[model samples]
Structure formats: structure tokens, C-alpha cells
Target: MPGLTFEKLLLIAIIAVFVLGPEKLPHYAAQLARLVKSLKNMASGAKDRLRDEMGPEFNDVDWQKLDPRQYDPRRIIREALLDDEGAAAPVAVKPPTRSRPVESAAQKRLGLAEAGAAAPFDSEAT
Candidate 1:
């Protein structure tokens, strides 16, 4: 990384220009690019060969599901909590219980006895 600074880069360009000359500098640069590409391919191939020799144990990787960019801490926490508490129960689709309709005065009186629940309605009957 340090070797690829602007000054080093300029120096390399100047040297390449001087050594290869202006006429052939472009050609040599293209050759250098091709060499770098081939070297990269060779290095990667070597890594694969090493892994192959090391057997399936070395290459026992799950590459499909792995990607650093997809990491999500909140999702992980939610999943862990759900698992810890056993699989989450299915959400109830029903509406919340509403106030029960008062039938007779006796039922209304009984409901009122329960306290703070249902207040007695002052209807014509009352």
C-alpha cells in the first residue's frame, strides 16, 4: 500500500516511459496489465488447488448464505429471543373483546358488582 503512493506512481510512470520509451510505453503498459491479470488468475487457481488437496474438510464452506453486507444485529436478536422462548405463537387474528351487551337488569347488576368493569346504563328500564 505504501509503495503505491502518488510519488511512487509518478516515478514508476517516468521510469516506464524512459525504459520503454514514449512510442512503446502504451504497449508495455498493456502487457503489464495483462501480466497482472494473469498473475491474479494464477494465484487464485493456486489457492483452489491448495484447498482441493486439503480435502473436503477444508472446503466444507457454506458460501451461498454468507455475505458481510447482509448482517443485521436487530434481526439476529429478534430471532434469538424467539428461539429462546420457543417458537413464537401464531398471532391471534381475532379482534379484541368488546363490552358485553347487558341483557336483563339482573345481569347488569351482576356485571356492576364485578367493579370498574361495566358501568350500569341509565336506560328507560332503569
Candidate 2:
């Protein structure tokens, strides 16, 4: 079904005719059809057996949710980390407070001002 298009199937048929010859082609084709039919019947029979063993619960089962391919690692981790209620509570934060300004090393070396005092301006430096 995936890769067997009409063109590819036609090519295969042509090749088979050349290899197997016209005389034996019909016999082989009938055998192949029978094999495919038997395989389908086996698969359906297995499904029916499983359904009988499972009883009415088989129809109630969520097939899509149970599928392994639908699972996501990130979502599983997130769910595991969450509370039983599912929603996360909001956190409270404190407002920032103003602090004293820092003094520069030049101001300390010049000895022009105290450690926390503002520096005096020099007109030439500008």
C-alpha cells in the first residue's frame, strides 16, 4: 500500500511475465491471491478471539489514548511534576528597595570625599 503504485505494479507484472513465462503466470497469481486471503482471515480471526476474551470491556477501551506512539516524554514529565489538582499555584514576590550608591576607586584614592560621599567635579576632566 505504501510503495506499490499502479506503475510499479505494472513494471513488476512485466518482469514476472518475462521471468516466469506466460504458461505458469496464472497458476502463480492464483496462489498469491489465496495466500493474501488466508493472511487477512488469520488477522481477523485473531482480532475476534481477543474481543471474545476481553468481553464487553474491549469496545470500551480507549485505543488512541493507549497507543504507544502518542506518548510524549516532556508532557509525561510535566504531568508527574504537577499536583493532584493539575494546576500550579502562583508565587508571591517582594517589591525591590533602594540601597546606597557604590563609590568609585578614583574617589577613594583622591581622598576628596568620604567612602559614601558623592565625588566633586573637575571642569578640565570633562
Candidate 3:
């Protein structure tokens, strides 16, 4: 984009003037103007065709809501496939429960802990 600045465009024009002398420069400039105008017309035609095909509903749809960042990951993917009516059930994340008393592996190997006793890690071993 920076290359399209006024200074760069002037540099390009100077180069083109040298390459295609004064007599041909004007002709090529006119051709370039026509090319740019035709490209803009083509883009407008495509947009008009889309509007015709989709009708009024095209403008009514909420494009921002359909964007993925607006919804939870699971709900968005599920919604795309029409797999559910209600929002996806919230996923619960927690550590696995340990019912018995806990001890470090080093404590058991060295016979340093009694049964059913929670022990801090061995400082030296750690």
C-alpha cells in the first residue's frame, strides 16, 4: 500500500514517460483509465447479481452474529451443522478426584511415610 503513495506514483509516471515517449504516453494513459473503469463496473455488477439472487433477506441477515468469534467454539461448530436446537451444554473442567490420602512417589519408595498420611514432597529429592 505504501508503494501507491503520491511520490511513488510520480516516480512511476516519470519512468513511463521515458519508456513510452510523449506521443504514446497519452494513448496508454487513456487505455489504463478505461481498464480501471471496467474493473469497477465488473465489481458493481457482481454485487448487483448477488443482491438479485439473495433478495431482501441478504440485507436482513446478521453477518456479525454468524462470525465465529461471537459464540462459544462448540456451539458455533454445532450450529453450522444444525445438530442441536438449544445451546451446547457447558463443559465442566476439573482435576480427577483422589479419595485416599496422598503421598509423593519418593516417600513410598524410601519408606519415609506412614499409611493414610499426606506428606509434602521431599525437599532434597525435589
Candidate 4:
């Protein structure tokens, strides 16, 4: 998730100058500029299409809430496990115990917890 800072961009530009040489640098730079402009146009076109199709409601829409970056598996599972009445009672998750390993629905389906099931082997893997 690290972003390209000014220093990082400068370093890359310096490296590209040596690698590409001065002769082809302008040509590649123009191509890169064109690519960026085309990407912008495409994005704008999509947004315009969506706005036209959705009408006034499009402007009122909460874009941040629709972002995929906010998705978290643990948060989703925790929310799903919450009680209907919103009580403080703990969620009952039956994980494999130390004394006796229990086969969960997922484990059973994956054949990982099946009795007498041998580990998968490939002769050529080694």
C-alpha cells in the first residue's frame, strides 16, 4: 500500500535517464503522457455514463461507502456473528479443541479432517 513519493519518483526518473539514454527519453515521455491522458478520459467517460444513467441520485450517492478498500473478512464475520437483539453474549464458534480435533464444515469439505485420509503426494514434486 506504499505510495510513490516525490523522492521515489525523482529516483525512478534518474534511473530511466541512464537506462533509456537521452535519445529515446523524449519519445517514451510523450508516450507515457498520452497513456495517462487516455486513462483519465476513459475514467471520466465511465463516470459521465454512470451519472447519466443514474440521474440525480448519482450525485447524492455515498462513493466512500461503496469503496472496495473498506472490506475486511474478520469485520464481516464478527458482524454476521452478532446476536439479533445486540446482546453482550459471546459468539459460539466451535474450532478444533486441543483434546480432540473437530472437523469443521469447511475442513470436512476440503478433506483435511477426514479419518484415514492420507496427505496428498505427487511423485514428481520432489
Models 1 onward score TM values of 0.40, 0.52, 0.47, 0.69
- Residues 6-121 of candidate 4 have per-residue lDDT tens digits of 99999999999999999999999999999999999999999999999999999999989999999999998877777456667767989655865566786677777966566678
Q: What range of 10 consecutive residues in model 1 has the weakest lDDT sum? A: 111-120
Lowest summed lDDT across 10 adjacent residues in model 3 is found at: 112-121
Give the candidate order by descending lDDT: 4, 2, 3, 1
Candidate 2: clashing pairs of residues: none
lDDT of each: 0.78, 0.85, 0.84, 0.88
Candidate 4 RMSD computed on C-alpha atoms after optimal superposition onto the true structure? 4.4
Error of 2 at 19 (Å): 1.2
* Candidate 3 structure lDDT: 0.84
Question: Across residues 1-126, which tens digit of lDDT does each residue of candidate 1 receive?
Answer: 544788998998998888888999888889999999999999999989988888877668666668876779999897787788667677889966748543567656576545346655668975
Residue range 1-126, candidate 2, lDDT tens digits: 677899998999999999999999999999999999999999999999999999999999989889998899998988777845766685788865647445567876878446456567789998
RMSD of each: 20.0, 17.7, 13.1, 4.4
| Model 3 residue 90 distance off true place after TM-score fit, in angstroms | 17
Give residue 26's lDDT in candidate 4 (0 to 100): 100
List ranges where model 4 is wrong by over 4 Å.
86-120
Task: Rank all candidate structures by their TM-score, best first, as comma-separated numbers.
Answer: 4, 2, 3, 1
1 versus 3: better lDDT goes to: 3
Model 3: residues with Cα > 4 Å off, grouped in runs: 1-3, 61-126
Q: Point to the candidate with the largest lDDT.
A: 4
Q: Choose 3 or 4, whichever is better by lDDT.
A: 4
User: What lDDT does candidate 1 reach at residue 50?
Assistant: 80
- Assess the local accuracy of residue 101 in candidate 4 as a C-alpha lDDT between 0 and 100: 59
